[model samples]
Target: MARKYQRANRMNWLMPVLFALPLLCLAGAALLLWGDQLRDLINIAVKLAVIS
Candidate 1:
């Protein structure tokens, strides 16, 4: 009985995060897809020089 109670306690804390993972992933994907359009952003430029 004591072990069961402890397991439930752990799951109570963990369950919400497990359930929210998919929504978090979806939000991240949406942000990546539309973030530039929604804000002013710049791409980094790389410089290369040829050795003489």
Candidate 2:
């Protein structure tokens, strides 16, 4: 009974990490593909802020 409880507790934390790994990979891939575009957007926003 105690072992089952321990296993369940371990899985509770592990589950979220397992779920997040794929999402993190996808985000990394997106950044790699569009990093230049993101940088341009940020620069544009900064310039607009300075102008205002």
Candidate 3:
């Protein structure tokens, strides 16, 4: 019982980080994949803003 309690205590701190890791990875992957397109979009927006 004591071991189980200790294990749960460890997991309580770890669980949220473990759950969030995949989401962080997915966002990183998306940024890598779409980086060029995003850069182009930002440049266009900047140009338009400057013109207007």
TM-score per model over all chains: 0.48, 0.57, 0.67
Q: After superposition, how far is residue 26 of candidate 1 from its true place, in Å?
A: 0.5
TM-score order of candidates, best first? Answer: 3, 2, 1
TM-score for candidate 1: 0.48
After superposition, candidate 2 runs with Cα above 4 Å error: 1-15
Better of 2 and 3 by TM-score: 3
Off by over 4 Å in 1: 1-9, 40-52
As a whole number from 0 to 100, the lDDT of residue 36 in candidate 3 is 90
Q: Cα lDDT of all candidates, in order? A: 0.75, 0.93, 0.93
Q: Which lDDT value does model 2 have at 28?
A: 95
Give per-model CA RMSD: 6.8, 3.5, 2.5
Number of the candidate with higher TM-score, 1 or 3: 3
* Per-residue accuracy of model 3 over 1-52 as CA lDDT, tens digit each: 9999998888888888999999999999999999899999999999988965
> Which pairs clash in the backbone of model 2?
none
The residue pairs in collision within model 1 are: none
Instruction: Give the alpha carbon lDDT tens digit for every residue of 1-52 in model 1.
Output: 9999998888888888989999999999988998886554323222233333
